[model samples]
Target: MAKTIFITGASRGFGKLWAAAFLEKGHKVVATARDLRSLDDLVNKYGTNILPLQLDVNDRAADFAAIAQAKQHFGSIDVLINNAGYGLFGSIEETTEQQAREQMETNFFGLLWLTQAVLPVMRAQGHGHIIQLSSVLGLVTVPILGLYNASKFAVEGLSESLAQEVKAFGINVTLVEPNQFATDWGSASAAVTTPMPEYDGARAWLQAAASEDKIGIPEATVPAILQLIDSENPPLRLLLGKQGHPWTRQVYEGRFAEWDAWQEIAAAAHGK
Candidate 1:
């Protein structure tokens, strides 16, 4: 079956690659971004099958409108990829309250609103898939990237619940956890906050970390995403990159083991 996909933030990076991959597979794509200028080449290449929609996923109204418009244009949307997210890298103490909120609004709430907007139409037709672009950080928190971790963690939870809630409706949800991909998403969205006097000595450490992360390439991720889309029994969570797999497994297993170890005490405290 030729799936109709609506992908957010398709103007560049992984989002762009995903859109192109779908188009190559003879599927219709409604590729959206905050700006459509960069999408012209894609639209020209794919022609009618590519609908370049200008959308700020953070804006509830705009997101809803874009989904509605895409549905009307494509007749129906079989897949929705919530890939419009950014990396907000800054220590908790250095990150401003507003910056943190903005990060959540875009990376977390944006997907939430878009999912809600598209659910009804999918439910009515009784078939759909929602793919969330999360990160390995979603599973394992790291220094200087707490906000991004929090946002993706929220997405991971949402994707899990959505998978179960909509299973009866034939709606599937898949969460993609990519390690470090070659995307401007890292450097372009890097958040630099006021250096804390307390950590002045560690500035070199932070800078070196950022420089190394910026070198990762993004080609491997799109293939995995496409495979998930084509898979008959897709995994609820698809961890990308060889490096990400073991880390994700360890983090999840460690958390579960810790929880199990404390289960009796927790249960007693809660009167279970």
Candidate 2:
């Protein structure tokens, strides 16, 4: 069935690809970017099937207004792809308070607000899918992306809780966790902090690693997302890409191992 899909950060990267994919499948798309002009090409190509709106997720008023406009324009929004987030590349110590706040505002709080706005409509209709674009970093930590990792971790936790809360209303929430994909995400959407002498070696390593070509293909994720949208029993968390699965498994296994090793000590704290 053709559905009305609402997407954020649709000017480029995964969001752009998803919007195009849906339009190609003859679905209605309400795509948004920080700048409306950035979506001119999408508007031109998809024509009336795509509604390009200007939106900065951090702006609560703008988010609400956009969601209202989208619901009004399309009559209903069957799916919401919350892909409006950017990376803040830096160690936790190096990242500024303001930068961290901005990261949380966009990646976590913005998603929360938009989901809140759409819940009423979804509840009224009794069915909807909310897809959140998280990352493998959400499951495991890495250097030079502490803030980004924190933001995604928050998204993962929030989305999991949201899924349970909205299930009774027939609203599904899925957190898409993808590893490094071949996108301008690391270059165009990334904000870097000032360098510190102590972290020079780690920073150099990260820079070199980032310069290498990414292994994951952005388009490969489209099918998974589409499947999630159409699924009657979608997972609360869907890890995309080949690397994401093994990497996440490794993280969870290591965590379990540590928990088992420290079980006696952990239990002692309860004074049992």
Candidate-wise lDDT, in order:
0.86, 0.89
- Superposed model 2: Cα runs more than 4 Å off: 207-214
TM-score, candidate 1, is 0.91
Q: In candidate 1, residue 150 scores what lDDT? A: 94
Deviation in Å, model 2, residue 187 alpha carbon: 0.5
Give the CA lDDT, 0 to 100, for residue 96 in model 1: 95
By TM-score, how accurate is candidate 2?
A: 0.96
CA error at residue 58 for candidate 1, angstroms:
1.1
Strongest candidate by lDDT: 2
Q: Which digits, one per residue and each the tens of the lDDT, describe model 2 over residues 1-272?
A: 99999999998999999899999889999999978888888788889899999888988988899899999998999999999999998888898889999999999999988999899999999999999999989999878998999999899999989999999999989889888888888888889899788998888887776544546888988888778888988888888887878777888999999999999999999997
lDDT of 1 by residue, 1-272 (tens): 78899999898888898899899999999999877898998888889999999999889999899989999999999999999988886778888999999999999999999999999989998989899989888888767778899999999999899999999998888998887866787678566677687765465565575555444567766677778888877889887876777766788899999999999999999864
Output candidate 1 Cα RMSD. 2.3
